[model samples]
Target: MPSVIESEVLIRVVEPRDLREVYEVESMSFTGSLTYDFSVFLFYYVTAHDLFLVAEALGRVIGYIIGLIEVRRREILGHVISIAIHPLYRGLGIGSKLLKALEERLTSRGALRIFLEVDVLNKPAISFYRKHGYVISGILKNYYGVSDAYIMVKEVGASLKQF
Candidate 1:
């Protein structure tokens, strides 16, 4: 089977066995005021199957998207809790691919929309998500300890280019 990433780095669902790399990417990609501890990753990254995703390059995972499901008044949605790509692999479409995969999975699971939050100062991420059809729907005041966040949401099943 062809690897998910074109450069032999495959984007795949995060399995229980991939915890070490997942945690490593989680720490390496996220810092400053909002880092989740290893125990939190271990406990929440998987529940029966997976609550996370990773991009693997030559047997090593270099990126991940961690998230959860939500429901309100019987409307279910997939929330893209977090996403990251290794510094070495930035700008190679890895983050976009991983995010697309997550959205695909969530849509297949009957999620009508996927939402996420980005730091107000995260220009690259905001631009990336906007490119992928996620729009800023609202903002959270003091979303983080010091920084505000833009809440973005995208409806699933908008468009699919050829494989």
Candidate 2:
């Protein structure tokens, strides 16, 4: 088997101009109506603009991740809103890098825990989160209309480490 080359993936804060390509990557990474529309992305940007991030290689946007923070009572909760990588960029560790970036940002802002919802059928994503120390907290019925979703949670300071 040939060795895998880990390309240089530059992670950075998302800019207004990057939305088009980010949406394209999001569309490619998901199927059916699960893909987020531009308006939803815009809403996330407007609400948590500082938490939006994108990964680039050779001047092309290859992956992206967005997060939201909420302070409930006294604890800061971090929510992984969305994450996607271009089909060609999968298995290159770009997603991992992007996730780490978001986690670091959340931690810097004093997030106590981080969580996300993933489609139950997406085994690869479930495995990825599990490797990152996320546990299944519960299930969201009909999270995607006809499909259910798994609620995954990870304690920020415990599991998310610098890479």
Candidate 3:
């Protein structure tokens, strides 16, 4: 049940040339210390290119999601490092599309579960994750230096049909 605009967005792996637009989306979606600069995006491109993806529409980058796979106590886990859509494209289902695309990629790579941290004040983001089956597992105090963050997780095992 995606809208026409949502249908037009193409989710694809991140490329070196997409970093500038991705950084612009990040800057528009976040503020102050919460925003990651171009260098961080470049680092992710070099270290975890496979898990990073972008949402392109009309030949321009409109959103992106960054993820990483890690082994924790012998369990392979997927981490959503960051996700953002341009301010003008907020409620068109682009974020959900980006998230689902990343989740499928991670699950295909043997991730048992997926995790992400969101600012406690971001109600829209929290709601978005919740709608996608993520639940708050814990809280990180002062995660943003000025506020707290909620650690959200969703299982991506074989039993989950969405995966």
Candidate 4:
């Protein structure tokens, strides 16, 4: 989590100039989102411009989440590929804020719902989404080339059913 330093923080779309910093975060974050032998994160960095996002604190990039819309079943939905916060900055609500920001971006693009495939072993992320109103729709076997994927979804607005 980021410190309560009252820094200027903003969430914005990924721009060309941000590629370097974004890649640095990607390289330091995780492998699935890395795509190209964990190098520069080029698989999506160079391919999906609109799906990338960066959270800048002060003048440095602090957090980021990558997502894109893809066909599931017969409809299109937003899928968050990755969301990471600097190790020292964990527990600051950065990941939640980034997810919400991505949801807004996906919604503006006609996405009726948002979804993600997270590692079943990633207890924190799964707990975070489940607590944030995301339900585990299903589970995919070896969805990420090596591990299973927990398919989670969150419907836009409100639903009649409440836990």
C-alpha lDDT values of all predictions: 0.79, 0.87, 0.91, 0.74
Which pairs in model 1 have colliding backbones? none
Candidate 1 per-residue C-alpha lDDT over 43-107 given as tens digits, one digit per residue, 9 for 90 to 100 = 67555145477888878887888767788679888888888877777888888778877787777
The positional error of residue 109 in candidate 2, measured at the CA in angstroms, is: 0.8
- C-alpha RMSD by candidate, in order: 3.5, 2.6, 2.5, 3.6
lDDT of 4 by residue, 19-69 (tens): 677667656767664343434456677765767888888677777888888
lDDT (10s digit) by residue, model 3, range 1-163: 2234888899999998899999999989999999997999999999887889999988889999999999999999999999999888888999999998898888998998999999999999999999999999999999999899999999887755663
Find the 10 residues in a row with the least total lDDT in model 3. 1-10
TM-score of each: 0.87, 0.92, 0.94, 0.80
Q: What is the lDDT of residue 72 in candidate 4?
A: 72
What is residue 37's positional error in candidate 4, in angstroms?
4.5
Better of 1 and 3 by lDDT: 3
Candidate 3 to native Cα RMSD, angstroms: 2.5
Candidate 2, 1-163: lDDT as tens digits: 2233455678998888889999999999899889999998788778888899999887778889999998888889999988998888888888888898899999888897998999999999999888777899999999998999999998878556634
User: Residue 52 of model 2: what lDDT?
Assistant: 95
Best by TM-score: 3
What's the CA error at residue 101 for candidate 2, in Å? 0.6
